[model samples]
Target: MSKADEKYLDIVENILNNGYYDNNRTGIETYKLPHQIMQFDLSKEFPILTTKFVAFKTAVKELLWIYKDQSNDVRKLQAQNVKIWDEWMLEDGTIGKAYGYQVAKFKQIDNLINTLKTDPQSRRMIISLWNIADLKDMSLTPCCYETLWDVENDRLNCMLVQRSGDIPLGVPFNMCQYAVLVHLIAKVTGFKPGLFTHVINNAHIYKNQIEGMKLQLKRRKQAYEAPTLWINPEIKNFYDFTPNDIKLIDYKHHEKIKMEVAV
Candidate 1:
């Protein structure tokens, strides 16, 4: 079984057996756990779940829309046929002062990249999207809101902080995309991909997703090996990457496990 699947399933099992049931703002009750973490070494293998198929290309598109394009327009994602954010898209044709808006508003990606290139050892390399002053303007507040970056021995590392995570539906997508982000940034900055760490303050599974989550749990014993991530060798610039340029080789997984979004 892939290490990613092992760690993810462990969390799922933990929540199912030990989590506290609680009501939240989304109007759905959840089985909640706190302070859950997952870490991966990119050099060993790309961390993507093997127990169920993750929409890797779709995740990449969403990541680019937020970090690379630095856009708040849902239209741009719709242009690529990605609709994950359709639920939160506002009538103004954007997601308000959330996500890409925050990135563009502060030019956070540019600043981080420049810092990695010019001041590799700087302790201030961070990108944050949780803008307190603009939360009221956002259609949805950012969940995976901050990223702290570091460089050592020509290797790039990242730590992602998420305020809340929808374990069954959202965490899988978030995990793979951020790992991809680490690789993309490492390539652009002329460093080897090192480690990617994810921390979720509140990780929960909605009541409606319980059955599907249990179905996935049953497939744990059959999980396949980790897949290799292939990035186009010629693309040194992060902005030059297209979905075609990033792919998984031999990504064998059980099947798609559908679950409704709580939002």
Candidate 2:
């Protein structure tokens, strides 16, 4: 079984069995568990679930749209055939002062790369998209907002702190994309990819998505091994990377378990 699935399924099982039932802004209530964490060694294996299909390319594209392109325009993603953000897109064709907007506004990515090269030991290396002042203008608050970076023994490590996670639909993508982000940053900064830790302050399964989660759990015993992440070594600069530059080789997994997003 894929190690990612092993850990992920455990969380799903626990949530269904013991999560706190509650109502939130979405109106559709959820079974939520607080402070759920998943840790993986990026040097050992790529952490993507093989128990069900995950849209690796689409996930990476949204990632690039944020940190690399520094864009909050939903039309930009739509141009690339990614409609994941369509639900929250505002009238001006952008998410408005969210995600990439905050990253660019604070010059977070540029400063992060520069700092990583000059001082690998700096403890202040953080990329945060949770701008309190900009929240009111945002179409939707950033869920997986902050990322803190560290370096140890020539390995680059990261901790992703998500304020809230919709386990069935969003969490899987969040885990994989951030892990790839760590690799991309490490490759550009001249270091090996080390630990990738995911922290979800409120991890929840929507009431309507419970059946999908239950079906995914049934495939746990048949999950495949983690896939090998292939990156184009020729591209040294992070800005040169495209969706095609990175890929998953030999990724075997079960059929897609369709789930709905609670808007």
Candidate 3:
């Protein structure tokens, strides 16, 4: 099993079995443990779940939708059969100028990639999508808000900062998607994938999601090993690539545990 899967499953089991039950702002009372972190060394393996089909293509599409397209439209996601954001889409068919907008507004992607290839030691290599100025305009704030990229020993590393998380509904998808980003960026910028770190400030299982968490935890230990990721060899540009360009070479996983998504 990949260390990523091991670490993630460990956290899932630890929280469900021994985390503190608490209430928070969303009225989505939770079972939360403070400051839980999971890190994967990508030099050894890709950090994707083999225990469950992680929708690697779909996750890549969604990531591109936010960062490349810079679109706030749910219709674009719907066209791709990804409805994960349906609940949070506004009546106007937009989720506000979130995610990709921030990326474009600050010319984030190119700037970061350039910095990574140039002065990688610079601590300012962060791309943030959580715009406090536009929060009220959004149905829901971006979950994977801040990402810091770095280089160590000629390999690319990334750290994703999530301010709030609904573990069952959001965390897993975010983990796989961002890890893919780290891999893709590494490929585009001429470096090997290194480490992927996930930090959740308010990592919680909602009251309604307790049973589901338990169910997932029951199968967590039984999760299969991590799978290999394959991106099209011809695809060099991140923005030009689509769902068709990325794939999971051989994913293996247990039965998926159903869970409610609390908006």
Candidate 4:
């Protein structure tokens, strides 16, 4: 089994068995646990779940829409046939000042790339989407926010701090995509992919998703080996990447687990 599956499954099992049942702002109750973490060495394996299928291409499209395009417009994602954010899109055709909007506001991606290129030893390399002043304007606040970057011995590492994570649906997508982000940024900045650390402050499973989560847990013992991530070697610029340029080689999983979004 992949190391990701081992770690991820452990977390899921922990939440299901010992989590606190409580009501939340979403009007749906949840089985939640606090301060859960997962770390991975990207050089060893790609951090994607093999117990159940994850929509890798769709995740990449959303990541690109945010970091590459720096857009808050849901229309751009819809243009690519990605509809994950359709529920949160406001009447104005945007997700407000939530994600890509904050990136554009401070040119965060540009600054991070520039710093990675010029000052590899700097300790201040960071990109954050949690804009305090714009919180009220956002349709939904950023969950997987704040990324801290590091460089060591020609390798790049990233740490993602997520304020809230829906374990069944959101966490898997977030894990794979952020690892891909590290690979993309490392390639553009001329470094090897190193480590990825994910920290979730409140990791929860919505009541509606419990059955789906249980079905996934049943396949835990049959998890397959980790797949290799393929990025186009010829692409030197981050913005040049598309869904075709990235792929998962030999990704094996049981099947898709259907779960409803709490929103």
Q: Rate the local accuracy (lDDT) of all candidates.
A: 0.94, 0.95, 0.80, 0.94
Pairing residues by index, what is the TM-score of model 2? Answer: 0.99
Model 3 TM-score on a 0 to 1 scale: 0.93
Per-residue lDDT over 63-151 for candidate 2, one digit per residue giving the tens place of the 0 to 100 score = 99999999999999999999999999989999999999998899998899999999989999999999889999999999999999999
Per-candidate TM equals 0.98, 0.99, 0.93, 0.98
Per-residue CA lDDT of model 4 for 1-263, tens digit only, reads 99999999899999999999999999999999999999999999999999998999999999988898889999999998999999999999999998989999999988999999899899999899988999999999999989999999999999999999999999999999999999999999999999899999999999999999899889988999999999999999888898899999999988999899988
- Model 3, position 245, has a per-residue lDDT of 79
Model 2 poorest ten-residue lDDT run? 1-10
For this target, which candidate reaches the highest TM-score against the unseen true structure?
Answer: 2
The Cα error of candidate 2 at residue 234, in Å, is 0.8
At residue 97, what lDDT does model 1 achieve? 89
Error of 3 at 215 (Å): 2.4
RMSD of each: 0.8, 0.6, 1.7, 0.8
User: Mind giving the per-residue lDDT tens digits that candidate 1 earns over 100-129?
Assistant: 989989989889889999999999999999
Task: Quote the RMSD, in angstroms, for model 4.
Answer: 0.8
Show model 1 residue runs off by greater than 4 Å: none
Task: State the weakest 10-residue window (summed lDDT) of model 3.
Answer: 48-57
lDDT of 4 at 198: 96
Per-residue lDDT over 1-263 for candidate 3, one digit per residue giving the tens place of the 0 to 100 score: 66666776677677778778877766767788767787888777777665555666778889989877878899999998999888878888988878877788889998988888788888889999877888887777787899988888789989999987777767778888898888889888888999899998877787787776666666656767777888888877778877777788768876666777766
